[model samples]
Target: MVQLGSRAGAPGRHVVLCAEQISKSFAGVRALHNVDFDLRHGEVHALMGENGAGKSTLMKILAGVHTSYDGSIQVEGQAASFSGVRDAEEAGIAIIHQELNLVPELSVAANIFLGREPLIGGVLIDRRSMIRAAERLLARLGVTIPPETRISGLRVGEQQLVEIAKALSLNARILIMDEPTSALSSSECDTLFKIVRQLASEGVAIIYTSHRIEEVLELADRVTVLRDGRRVVTAPIGELSRGAIISAMVGREITANESGKTAQDGAVVLSVRNLTLDTLGPHGWRRTLHGVSFELRRGEILGIGGLLGSGRTEILESIFGVSRGWRDGNIAIDGAPVDINSPADAYRLGVALVSEDRKERGLHLGASICDNVALPSIGVLSRFGLRSFASERALAADMVKRLSVRCSGIGQDVAALSGGNQQKVVIGKWLGTEPRILLLDEPTRGIDIGAKQEIYRLIFDLAAQGLGIIVVTSEMPELLLLSDRILVMCEGRQTGILARENATQEQVMRLAAPGMAAWSQVSAS
Candidate 1:
């Protein structure tokens, strides 16, 4: 490995990358404006801002993903202008995007060495050499994933690790990590932090971007915050507190832990009895969920907490009738048993699911905001057998206003909106259906602090309106904040349910830990 000159503990390291007067716009809208940034060798510089605050835009410009941006970049004190990602790579820059970019049909080794595979005799591909290299990289990261394993076979967190390994394979001097641990477990995050520190010690410059405040406080040497497409502040991590960082990012003090109105003891609205699900994996049928039971009451938020693959999302999928598996469960709405064999049935019964992956499952990116919001209510908005454009527009306009979606107009494409706005569109889409029961899976996954506050407020307002909500989140704080009653899951089973008064982080983790036998005692008590 090339040593650029280490300064692991020193904050005055030499600059490895710098950007001046960086500005980018999409169509006629300004996404970034005169943002200046610089990174030092062997330093983790965190770039923070709410969604659409131009962090992603600036990173794209640096990584050569957005070539039309107006900026001057310098590498090693030399003027650098990249026309494409290839140019950035040649300049020893690599970016691990927030979204995974891999071929699901390909093996891990193939993905790692994609577009630059080793060859024999200048013609034939050297598969054996590639697999060996991939194995070494995975081992270096302290993971045991086989090089020959297909990407589709791995979980989301494992896929993120592969992205990291792929970036490391480039031998880049500068690395940009965008929300790298959003899908990782706590143990996996610790491993990643170790690797990051080791790389920094070896003189690699890293620019980290995340909405996670604690991770930034722990990992970054210095932090820069942006807002409304402009640079707000840049300061050393030691000089910043959590409140300071959030204030700089959002331009306001946010009480993230402020308790909302307590849920009323309303009547039971939905109940599940001994729910079980069997999914068809590559190795045939595997039981994904077992004996999961819960009750959601009107004006209550029921939060599900668990590790990745611990059946948190599966529970929501099964309830929304979108699980790609055979499910055996008894579901009752208002004390009457109901059969939900498909999403249509669930919809007809006033059940709406805001999926975890908003880009893929929730919204149609290419469609207009009006189109996406009016999708679910199309049938109801139509006139007899004819489509009612006027009514659709009216419904879309109403939802956009109600959700406070920031957009030019309803005619704008959903893809052009920010991450936060896109999520609002997803929720608005479901709300148009006027569902009594709402299921939200990672509703604020990639969103920033300001948007999170908005969504939290929305949830509280919905519950106050007597909407029964079931939320599945990996964030412990979010789980504790939103739920009136928390259901902790481990593997496929229900561990225990803690009422809001008793739901501490320790108690939730104790129940969420796999192979723990304390559930019986907790349930009995």
Candidate 2:
């Protein structure tokens, strides 16, 4: 490593990177405005903001992903400009995006060294050398995944670590990370923290961005908050509190726990009985869900909690009629039996699902916001087999304003929007379908604190309007705060259901955990 400035823990070190008067715009909409940022060697500088707050736009400029920004960049106190990602990489700068970028069929080594694999005699690829190099990098970072393992074989957490390893393999001096731990579990997040600290200690300047407040408090050396495409505040991490960060990000005194849930004992809206789902795998037929039964009442928020592969997502997807290995299910709406063979069937019955993988299962990124939001309701908004563009635009415009989705216009592609904004579009699209029952899976998975509060408020408001909502989340606090009742699942089984007044995090986790003692007791009960 090329040592620079003082070692870790030494304040006032040598400046590694700086940006001045950075501004960017897209199609007449300013995404970033006069943003200035600087980073020192061996420091973790957290970029804080809600989605569409211009944090990503600023970082994209730094990483050479957006080269048209009006700004001046300095590296080692010398003016520099990058033409593309290649220029950024050559300048010792690299970024790991929140969305994992890897080919699933390839081995870990291949993904780590993609586009620049080692070669023998400057011709054929050197697979052996690449694997060895990848192994060395992973081992140095304390990651234990085998280099020969296919990327698809690893869990999401492991995949994240691989991304980190790939960035480090480039010997990047300035590392930009966006929402690096969003998909990780608690233990996995701890592991990532260790790796981050280790990298910082090695004199790497890390520009970290995340919606997680506690993480910023624990990991950041300095914090720069952006709001509405402008720099709001820049302060040392020690001088800021979680509440202060939240207040700065959203310009409001919104508490971290902004749950406004009240008493919910309305009539039953949806009911299920002995819903079993099966799938065929390499090992032949296997049950992904077994004898699951639950009831969702009108105006009730039902939270489902479980570990990965605990069949939490499977339950919601099965109900929406969109999941493999889904069969032998009995479903009813308002005490009337229903047959749903597909998502179309589910939609016709006034059921809407906001799927977990937004990229793959939810929104149409390449399409305009108007099209994506009006997708489910196109039939109703059409005349003589042609869409009424006026009504489509009106519906999208109304939902966008109602959801507070930050966008240039309804004509802009959904892909151009930020993650939170994209999520809001997904929800808005389903609302256009006019569903009585809403199923949300990991609804706020990667959204920031401010966006989360807004979403929670939306959920509360939707439930208040007598919509039955079922939410599946890995975050326990979200489960506890939003749900009128919580259901814990463990290994394809419905372990337990607890009322909001009596449900505890410990109790819910015990039931969600597969081998816990409470699992057997809850299943029996």
For candidate 1, lDDT tens digit of each residue in 1-525? 322223337488889999999988887889989999999989999999998899989999999998997879999999999999999999999999998999999999999999999999989989999999999999888788889989998777789999999999999999999999887766677778888888898888999999989999888999999999999999888899999999999898998556555566788899999999999866689998888888888988888887777898888888888888889989999889999988999999999999988987899999999999999988998888888999999988998999899999999999988888999999999999999999999999888988888899999899989999999887888888898888888888888888888889998888877776335525411
Clashes per prediction?
A: 0, 1
Model 2 clash count equals: 1
lDDT scores for all predictions? 0.89, 0.85
Q: What is the lDDT of candidate 1?
A: 0.89
Candidate 1: residue pairs that collide: none
Assess every candidate by TM-score.
0.94, 0.86
Q: Give the Cα error of residue 63 in candidate 2, in Å.
A: 1.7
Leading candidate by lDDT:
1
> What TM-score does candidate 2 reach?
0.86
For model 2, the superposed segments whose C-alpha errors exceed 4 Å read 1-12, 27-30, 77-79, 104-108, 128-162, 256-264, 278-287, 326-329, 384-386, 406-409, 491-493, 510-514, 521-525
